[model samples]
Target: MYGRILKVYPGSLAEELELVPGDKLLEINGTRLRDIIDVSFAFADEEIEMLVEHEDGQQEVYEFDKDYDEELGVE
Candidate 1:
């Protein structure tokens, strides 16, 4: 399962990674994301590997080693 990025906040990690509103979140740390609830558990990791699909059908991978408490700033 995958979750589409409906919104990316300004100055957010997603925005910093150049993610757009239409980006689809395919995976996190190699695990498929099935629902919103999974986000809390998955994002708790200080290191994250996110696979994103853009509206133009382009795919990009992002690696994050941020503070565990840092917000993703997305919905």
Candidate 2:
């Protein structure tokens, strides 16, 4: 999925993770992300590993643990 982030909400988990608008969300725990719904479902787990591809073509991995119903805090 071309799961590009369009925006990052203030004080959100995404922001906490330093995710920015235009950052492409590549995967979650090695599973490719296809869309927002996919993101939501993947985030259901308390333990998450996000693969983010930046606009500069650099890839980064972010892992964190949160509640099952935790919000991404994005807009």
Candidate 3:
């Protein structure tokens, strides 16, 4: 299962990663995502490995080391 991105906020990590609406979030930190709750838990970590499938069907992995409070900025 994948969580679809509806929006990527300006000045957010998601924006920096070039993620956009319609992109599908596949996994975080090597764990496949099933729902928003999983996403929330995954976001608690400072280090993240995210796999995203673009609207065009291209898959990309984005890794980041961030402050614990920093937000991914996607809804």
lDDT of 1 by residue, 1-75 (tens): 788878889999878887877789888888888898787778889999988888898888999798989878777
lDDT of 3 by residue, 12-41 (tens): 988888889999999999889999999889
Query: For each candidate, what TM-score against the reference?
Result: 0.90, 0.91, 0.93
Question: What TM-score would you give candidate 2 relative to the actual structure?
Answer: 0.91
RMSD (CA, angstroms), candidate 2: 1.1
Per-residue error for 54 in candidate 1, Å, reads: 0.9
Model 2 residue 51 CA deviation (Å) reads 0.3
Model 2 per-residue lDDT tens digits across residues 19-40 = 9988988898778987888888
RMSD, every candidate, angstroms: 1.1, 1.1, 0.8
Using lDDT as the yardstick, the better of models 1 and 3 is 3
Candidate 1 deviant stretches above 4 angstroms: none
**Of the candidates shown, which would achieve the greatest lDDT relative to the real structure?**
3
Count of backbone collisions in candidate 2: 0
